[model samples]
Target: MEFLAVVMLAVFTAGYLVLAGADIGVGMLLPWLGRDQDERRLVIASFAPFFLGNEVWLVSAAGIVAGAFPGLEHTLIEGLYPLVVMLLAGWVMRDMGLWLRGRVDAPRWRGWCDGAIVAGSWALALAWASVLGSLLVSAMSGGTGLNAGTVLGLPLAALFAWHGAGFARWRLPEDLAARAARVPVRYAVSGAVLVAVAVAAGSGLSWSDAAAEGSALSMTAVTTAAVLPLLMAAQGLVWWTFRGRVESPSYL
Candidate 1:
């Protein structure tokens, strides 16, 4: 029974990682993908359509955590007020940026709205990475949420930002898309490597539970389910996108 519970929680975590990671990535990457007016607008269009769907996992996971593993929720989220606040703020800004950017008439106003998206993306990625660091270390010792805004967290944010940039680069006008195609491949590879290491660390953490012998395989299978599609998509993008050539008339 306990084993099933652990497996479910692990699955939830994996789901959240891939979906929410892309959400945050969209926010972070959008800022740099557009070099000018029309290009930025195209970049925004690239992600605005699908980003909302990413929230389903977060909503479902929250319900599961609150209902099934209520105790573990307390263990993890306790004293983590700042991260929650940061997360909420980011979500709001990103969404607002998505909506308002389109509505605004002035280019400058639209840019500000887009900038909000960048901030939201930046914030979300950092918060997630900080949480990962806490999970890895089993402690949020540096004043809990207050210090989640650390240098380490920033790198995670940078990665997400880069990820967002890739989305923008690919989705935007041909000239900008060409530039972005070059970057997404590298960022996707790095994000995958980060996940691989985290999976290794998680496997190492499970070493003490000799009785629960199946956890290693369970974790491996669950994680592979979440990441393999992403890996394949990235590989395909690299193979298909020749010399950063933007495929126009749209066949993504």
Candidate 2:
């Protein structure tokens, strides 16, 4: 049960890193990828169909932690409280930007929304990197400082931008795709690396020590395992339905 819980957490974390990372990356590079308001709308359109769905993986990962590995959840939250707060704030900001961007028709309103999107995306990427860095350091060494996070955060954020560019290459039209092409890395490769990093981080953790006891662990693991397939199916449906490249602005 402990092993199953750990695996499920890793799966959801990796899934979020690979799937949502693309959109987050795109959001980070919104200004460059979109340029004009119309172009920005196009760039937003590219990943708009999938962002909300992608976010579900993050929520699921959190659920797994809180339910199956309550000790780890408490540890991570306590140790990484600031980063966690930043992550949630960035998430709310980005989602608000996406949701409100189309609600108003004025250029200024749209511009502010775009700025929110970009800033929030960058914040999310940096916060995740810092969190991962802290975890890696704590796992490998016995340190709890932000030094590793500070050192690792920028590079990981850059990787996020690169990953977004790769996604843009596939999702955007020719001109915007060309703009995204500046990154020079394939989306699949970058995404795979992101997933690998997440896996490595999870593997380094002491899950056996951190998991819930007895029935709590078993029930949470079983429930998550049962629900995962349904979540995957729903995700698959969304991806398949919107697989085609965006030709115009979406409702975002």
Candidate 3:
């Protein structure tokens, strides 16, 4: 039952990573991909449908950790208190930017909000990556994992950028969408290389390690290793199904 709970938690975490990661990635790329107000609106509208709902998985994951693995939760919170605060602050700032962008007419004000959106998204991505990297390092070494996590910020940022590009390709239109289509391949390849390096640099724990131990950590690791790929595959299929030019909405 504990193993099952851990596995369920991993599933929620994977969902958050795919869904919310893409949302954040979209925010991160708004300034880069959006040349004008209409283009920027399209980029923002792409994920607007599910943006708030997607965060449920993050909350679910955190709740599971606090409920099921209280000790781990305590440790993680203590070690990453600043990051946790920053993550929350970033989200709040980004949300404000998203909402205010539509309301404001002043070019200078909109530009400032746009910059905030990107900065907030970048901060969130980097903080999340650092936390995961630290946890992975600590999991392997049975010690504090702060430094390695900080080091992993770049690749993860690139990975999220790739994610956003994939989304733009699926949801944007015309030359904008075509341009987005070209972005993912480059970032995906580079991000994959960096991730490979990170994995290789670590202690290289395997499925066998999970199977041998039958512990909570092992269950989480095994579940994540098995499930994340599947989630990503499904995300790709959804994108493919929705690919090509964005259709005009009935309201529009």
List TM-score per model, in order: 0.67, 0.96, 0.73
Cα deviation in Å at residue 128, candidate 1?
A: 1.4
Candidates 1 and 2: which is better by lDDT?
A: 2
Could you give candidate 2's per-residue lDDT for residues 1-252 as a string of tens digits? 788888888889989988899999999999999879999999999999999899999998998898888878777777778888998999999999999999999999999999999999999999988887776767677544455654565567777888999999999998789988877889889989898777766666677778888798899899999988898899899999989779988877
Give the C-alpha miss distance for residue 125 in model 2, angstroms.
Answer: 0.4
All models, RMSD in angstroms: 6.9, 1.4, 6.0
**Which one is best on lDDT?**
2
Candidate 1 lDDT, tens digit per residue, 8-120?
54555555555456557755766556667565566655544445555655665565455454544554566456676777788788778777776757978977887897887
Off by over 4 Å in 1: 139-151, 165-174, 184-191, 197-252
Which runs in model 2 stand beyond 4 Å of their true positions?
A: 143-147
Clashing pairs in 1: 28-161, 29-164, 29-165
Sort by lDDT, best first: what order?
Answer: 2, 3, 1
* Model 3, span 1-252: residue lDDT tens: 455655666567666777777778888888777887667777777776556656777886776675556665655677678778888888888878877876766878877778788888988887776766775666566664355655655366666777777767767776777877776454344334434544433333222222323365555545655766775576567656545556442111
Model 3 lDDT on a 0 to 1 scale: 0.66
